[model samples]
Target: MTAEIVRTIPGAQKRTNDPEGMRKKVLDVAEASFQEKGYHGSSLGDLMAAAGVSGGALHHHFPTKKALGLAVIDERVAEAVAKTWIGPVLAAASARDGVRLVFEAAADELEKQGFVRGCPLNNLAHELSLADPDFRAALARIFRAWREAIAEKVRADQQNGGEKGIDPERFAALVIATYSGAMSMAKTAQEATVLRQCLAALPVSGQPAA
Candidate 1:
């Protein structure tokens, strides 16, 4: 329904102020906070206050900060990939259309979210790729799968009788690289316009980059 390519769709407002509910609330709040402030910037006290939960309760959900960070990345990446990149791309008219659709949807999601959270994979890539190799590997797998899916669709289109010039394999890689790079730049500038401009410029049909 909304652009959530990079960020979680802000959950329903913390409804019940009960204890068990509050712990879940803390996790939700911490998730959003981590996305907003990064792992280092999010303080336990701050997260607790936002959650309206006590320190003991917060710790129950996550005993350590690193544990919580990994959970956040794992869950967020799965949800984000399904929503912003994978499903819709697979639903397009063809492989080329699939690639175009994903970019268009990504751009739309970023702008609709006001580009606040930006892309989670891109966010993680910038920080964790060097700081945490395991996290980086996990995220890299997601990107690779995404590119492969797009490439597969493109190959299918070619076999089924589609347009010309574009090498689906190469083009899929470019789309992934371009979109990721564009999102990173847009987030840094706090403007979706830059990424939107790049998306607008991608030809729906083009020769795969040699």
Candidate 2:
């Protein structure tokens, strides 16, 4: 039976009557699982067990594994990028300064978390981009959104006479590429130092603090 039909089951109704809550729970569990295990490595069974939901409940929200992964990308990963990077960069005085601040903040977080895993978008892109066209498109959208956000800020900074020498598009690409590469290296080495070094070398047009 479909998840909608199975939701009528007495136990299912009692446990997950709130559709939004169930969906969020599934996304939360799936995001963690996918980040830890990659898309292929994580299975529907693992999601069901981690989310404490039955097969029917899982299917009700996400009909297929690909659907679930895309939802996680659109919802969880996109929200994370907006919150962590886009928002902060937009709020900063200049794009270059924003890049510096965001990287420093991210470095602090990585240090606290021990830096074993890398960027979620990068991790998934490496795992699923070539294997699935849908995944590639979904991830490409996120990366584009992220790059556009930073690029917009960079353009604004240039117009405001902050850093006219740098190309906004090129700078944004550099920031993303550098961070993604550093995170991969950090994950491989199981060390936050790699990330710190990369952040230190970022070509942000900001002066080091005295």
Candidate 3:
């Protein structure tokens, strides 16, 4: 009977009595709002309306706007980074190739979207990193994980007789910084040219010396 109930309403995540479900719904709405409008730009009312929950329901899950924003950063933003960057980078042939593929994919995605909304982690970091200590810490942790993942791949390539003498940590940082700045530029230009140009500039194409 219980399994049938779940099967019938597989999409029923907004059920009022399900606190966990309700929390997830609110977080999803808040994450999108933050990505689209920024932290300060998105009001609690806006989140509630978009989430289709009462003010009390929203408050019960998130007592304040900051709490909601932090949750988005910790959960939604972190998951996105893992999916969009970390996993793909690790799964690629080499760190260099992985980095190139990431840039190419990002450019393609922005083109498909027809407008750049910028990277989610980058967007929130710019708006909230300095606004609060907790925000900075959370964003910094994600950045570290991202960089380390790249560095890990780089080290793997080094072991396999590629990327000789390259400092994995520094190389990883450069890859991240380059893409981040390029994305910011792309957002401003409302096009993917900067992203493509940045990708071209990266030394991700050559083979290591024997």
Q: Where does candidate 2 stray beyond 4 Å?
A: 1-20, 205-210
Candidate 1's error at 94, in angstroms? Answer: 1.8
TM-score of every candidate: 0.76, 0.87, 0.88
| Candidate 3: residue 15 Cα off by (Å) | 4.4
Q: How close to the true structure is residue 50 of candidate 1, measured as C-alpha lDDT?
A: 84
Compared with the true structure, what per-residue lDDT tens digits does model 2 show for residues 61-141? Answer: 899998999999989999989998999999998887788888888878878887576789999999989989999999999
User: Which of candidates 1 and 2 is the stronger one according to lDDT?
Assistant: 2
What pairs collide in candidate 3? none
Per-candidate clashes come to 1, 0, 0
By lDDT, is 2 or 3 better? 3
State the lDDT of candidate 3 residue by residue for 165-190, as single tens digits: 78999999888999999999998999
Most accurate candidate by lDDT: 3
Better of 1 and 2 by TM-score: 2
Arrange candidates by lDDT, descending: 3, 2, 1
Q: lDDT value for candidate 2?
A: 0.86
The collision pairs in model 2 are none
Task: Name model 1 segments beyond 4 Å from true.
Answer: 1-24, 109-115, 163-165, 205-210
